[model samples]
Target chain A: MTQRPSDTQPQGEGNGSKVNRRGFLKTVAATAGVSCLPILQTDANAFSLDAFLQKHFYEMSKEELERVIERLENEYKKTYNKKEFRVGVDPPLAGVRFAYALNLAKCIGCRRCAKACVKENNQHRGSEERGDQIEYIRVLEMKKGSLDLEKSNHYYDHPVPDKDSYYMPVQCHHCNAAPCTKVCPVEATWQEADGIVVVDYNWCIGCRYCEAACPYWARRFNFSKPRIPDEEVNTNTHYLGNRPREKGVMEKCTFCIQRTRKGLNPACLEICPTGSRKFGNILDPQSEIRYIIENKRVFILKEELGTDPSFYYFFD
Target chain B: MGPALYFLVSAGLVFASGPGRGEVKTVERRSVLEDQHGYYPCSDCHADQETNPKPRFLQEEHDSPLEWEDEAGNTHLVEFGEKLAIGDLLGHGGQTGNRRRNLVKVGARLDVAQYMEEQGLSESDSVYVLTHGGANLWCLDCHNADDRDYLRKLNGEKLSFDDSEYLCGQCHGPIFIDWEHGVHGRTNGYWNRELDQKDVTRRLLCIQCHIPHAPRFRGVVPEAKPVPRLDPVSEPTAESHGHERHRGEYDRLGPHPWVETASTGHAEEPAHDGEKH
Candidate 1:
């Protein structure tokens, strides 16, 4: 095998001076910086990337976190070209209220909605590093001839609707009986009060228990730094939706909690062309979504598992 | 030369392929470049393009001759209390069956051109059929929609709205950008578990916020330009006031950076043409 050029090797034609002098210097400086630092450098008092993220998401008070929020706000505006932005720190959540619903009949195997969701949620479209499988929604195109529960499709080819086809969009159920939550050795993943399951990405260890524990292949682990471009990024990132995730953490959809809980509709709901999905407060009958669930023929996926999912699907 | 060439193209009669399998030998059918399938013929609506050679011929053949030239070299025909340039109808300026109190609207469009040519008159100045209206919209701009139907012209031809998005995209680049980003209009699914399956429908970017009837070119984006990063709305717009009824000024409202470029709850119109929910 041909040997690669050595950073310090002299190969200037017949002149034997090092051609890659600059590369050699950079490598040397990097080595020196790494060697000089202790294995665990104490920040005078004591703080680390993991330890700080371990704090409750809402632990930072207004006075303590004001500077941080402002900094992120400015960063977002500068990057997105938005002006006069209002970014609120999470005051607190009564509980992580998560809900989802899919319409089986109207989902016509058109994955235009899937593409929109991918863009909105910042799921790396290409192969993700081990811990980073970000696609929260998968459209299952079932054959019109076979409606078999066991034999339905999870794969879709281009130029859809071969006579008879139905689309079923899948995402994390945020199970009330969350298997992944049970197996977290580090207490990193927890169920919020409002029915949403959340993982403190910073607190997660590289343990794969959560991955194994879940029946619905929902959770994904990030093995490397996320590779989303700065421009395509949705800068109004919540912990769940648009933010660039870190290495070695598990992530999934948050129902666009960043937008939904604040009285805004989820991005997918906002852009559906054929009106095949629905959302609203389950508690409020007057809510458009509630009226549908109460009045329509509603059913959940994998009902036997008894996850008691907030999501429900229905037909007329 | 431009005018002369146009005049030649107008007068030169040629048979051409038209909508569907049939042959289209008229200028009217040939003018529309895109929507050949939906081409409405000239004589089908009015007389044949051959019948109207120019203002003089149109007047003599149709039994009327006039010109609508004024001191500024063009007559100010009025309609909707606005001056409209009818230069698209060149050389055929005259009094028409369309008029008010025997006087022209300051900027009339269709009628005066026909009337002036019928009168067989000329002005010291050349005609400026019309300029950009107060809305600053050129006649050829939004009117290029592929499905337009033209009534009468000697050339017997029509045009398309190919360059239209550029005109609309000018003020609404944000909407256009958002559109390109797959965020502006409806494409897929959204969940409001509260809504019925049929309730969620296509999202309308242009006709949604802007009333569809006039759909006057508004901001750069379609009416519903998504400011994703959450710049607070200082005050509610007429379109948004119903759902986002809290009428107060926002301190700062904007989208996040890195990309260019919301809710409803209320008794929406029972006949909302947009995608539901």
Candidate 2:
């Protein structure tokens, strides 16, 4: 029966200050209110109060989501100096769970997918001044004989399929039991019914806890305001996917949720010259992913962690 | 009222019976022959001339190799002009001496193995090999001798250029099967079959990616490296992160040491014990 120091302290007498629960709560409320005052005041402009108080994606009604999309579209149009901007909110289709299979043998260490991802996702294009570049995919050039990730080079600059090396492009695996989602303090990130793990950009508090928790180095933080050029900004955006993210929010691969939800192949898959990247609905019996899993030498990145990633790497 | 009801029922039945679930609908694809610029419609060149179905070394348009020198003072050679289905040798048999001599010529380049061995270069040093089935095939083997435009199957069925997958599938059965299932090759457009309203889902034809004469994918300069992050995070030291978890895992889970054999779809045993776990 040890009394804690806080319980033993005389509330009104300590240091000539009367600090009780009520006082502490009042202080907290005032701080929160003051912090949110800017967002509250900027209702008419880009930072709308409604946007700040926007509910989680799943909780939002159809009408509410529509309104949010309209607001975002307007905001993006002004910010990116575009005539028209679309914010798609397509829900996951029935009996469809998206999965990706990359042919490791076919991947020639070409970063076409990475570049295409940046362009399609509206990520910050780093300049000399800003010094912040965000890429969703990292193609690791590993020696043919080794599986040591430490020995793998992320920044190999040469004509690829380099003598004794093989390329392995790693991205957000969108795990069934995602560590990133579990550690999300604000419940901003979660796995969709279609197995695509997404983050609500507006709801994220930039804690970076999810980033640290991710084993695949999937989560990327916007350390500064994303500096996308007006011309380069991708107008087609999704709320829980690749809508141009604000500063401090965590962003990763959403399986191109904006595109995938509409039954279109992801930008990376489309741009791959080598036909290395494969994507399909795993639930469907006729899907290429199922074929690869069944026939090819398929393996997940970190099977021991029990992440059960929808992404599979295979060899022909 | 009876006649009107009967007519409506008949119309509904007709619409319902248009295409059954199992009915095979031919996907309308752009003609591969028409897509080939400058060198399609083999009949254009062969129609007026007499057909010589002899297997001989190409001495004309198809034989000219485009040669150039790079900034590094190294010579680079590229086979230019129309790629015929013909190989170095005409057919199998009666060319044993020639085959033994030309065996050193892997792909388009002659004496490559000898050159590599003399230079003490590894197999990877060579950029690419450009032969189809080790020059074992003749033009008439796949290409129809009767009709220059149509490809010939083993059963002598004439196939259009667009249906070259069927021709390729004759020899590369496993890969063809994988391609048909959308596993081996690139698939563009809609991933969902049901929602493919515009018929955007297009599996690339064999000839689209691979030249009939040289099927091996050539290595090329990759895209630019990602801009390095400004504030570099300290990497985890090798000692702290020992390879205990991945020590034996590489052998079992790393790229399998299976040799690709065309005859049987299954992977053959590992070439040597060094590659095995």
Candidate 3:
């Protein structure tokens, strides 16, 4: 709203117009309100008007994105009490289409990758008092002779490679034809140029449509405000990847977007003691993923559903 | 040609045709001996020791003595060679089997003259009979007898311990191909070399995962399992309880004191609005 000083002015400035007390008060009030506008825009929680009115990641201009990043960095630094916190927006590299491969014969069902995922991303550490546990990778122990997922056990706690069973770890596949993206009412989640399906936490409307639509059950809804220990928080976060998520929003694996964009492998891949996980740009003919897809007996989960996931599982 | 010469020629041929045939080498490998081997640079212990070239059961340096219980309920210290024979008889599949395979495969080439003499057996005895070819591998088949420091290839070419993969590839041809293609072994660091020049990709050497004597990977106790997702009832059962004791009180609480104070410092200010309006 423009200042009402002009409307209050009875005459021109040089003609001695500001004689009335009421008009003076009005002008002073208007100027004071305008001066306090910025203070009122932000609250005690650091939930700023800028963040509330922030545009979609794709729609934001370079300058706007920079300002948003700065605001997020400040917010996260304050929340986590970290001296070095960064919110990176590194985009997809040229001629790179990311793909992942897992050697079924090699995975030992150690769940080290799952633990590493929780630490790398700032997922909620669950407890009896506050029950919001979230992990990206779920290693399923399947029977030796069956491909039936329903028969697989997720809670086997013993030395792995049970003589009669095999382990199959399932996670967000980042499908080429992602069903989660299609079901997002607010278009908050979508597949990126590099074949990673990312969710804009700010844009999600907490509708849970995408969670229901996902065939792999890859999507996770934050039932309560995510509770991450300040010390355990991963300060090196990406805007759309492992950044702290809010209550009621959806989040999933972005293949460690913060790390991968800078040429580092995903946290799970690095922590796999079995060396079963392999990831690389499928577009690169010399890449490991390409070699696997070309030579190994690779297969995608639920291929008949036609999700066409970039992730592949192969036997030795 | 003799069996040794034929084996050498075939091993050389395989090395020539193995992976990394034409590709620009990008995978940086760590030195296997320095990183994994506890007792390396054999010269450290064998510098003044006499070299015994005979093919016989190792009774001293290489022997890992095992405790054995005889039929009379008496315990005895059994050497690795005797243990290997016992394990082979019992059809065991772990360390014992691995050692037996390695020793038997190597012993196939050497004359085993000392072994035959100790057992009081002739060349015609089935127990002491030696088979030729790739199956009969011995310690000197890989290790150089003249020089204790270097390993010798099948073709009698000396190789440093760092180049042990070349020797391993002679028999494990297919696995070596997979390892070179970056599919079988563990590789850490940058997946995309073009993006970051400083973070060089390091692939784990074969010896890093498998012991030279016992190549089989023994079963490991895995990390803890995930918390089961079930409805919370009035009473919490053992099945429903998570690893709560492992976590600290700070993790279960609301916003931490420092964060709470930093974000909500203005909340402490008195409410003057009640009288102002």
Best by the TM-score measure: 2
Specify the poorest-scoring 10-residue window by lDDT in model 3 chain B.
B81-90
Q: Give the per-residue lDDT of model 3 (tens digit) for B91-171.
A: 232444444555456455445655556677544443321222325555678788888889999899999988888888988
lDDT of 2 by residue, B101-213 (tens): 44334333335445545556554332333356655666678878888889899999999877888899999999888877777777778777667777756767676667676
- Candidates sorted by lDDT, best first: 3, 2, 1
By summed lDDT, the worst window of 10 consecutive residues in model 2 chain A runs over: A40-49
Q: DockQ order of candidates, best first?
A: 2, 3, 1
TM-score of each: 0.45, 0.73, 0.71
In terms of lDDT, model 1 sits at 0.49
List iRMS (one decimal) for every candidate: 22.5, 6.1, 6.6
True contacts kept of each: 0.07, 0.51, 0.46
Candidate 1 matches the true fold with a TM-score of 0.45
**Docking quality tier of candidate 2?**
acceptable
- lDDT, candidate 1, at B133: 31
Off by over 4 Å in 1: A1-54, A58-88, A91-98, A128-133, A145-150, B1-277
What is each candidate's DockQ, to 2 decimals?
0.03, 0.24, 0.20
* Clash number by candidate, in order: 81, 0, 6
DockQ value for model 2 = 0.24
Give the lDDT of residue A25 in candidate 2. Answer: 90
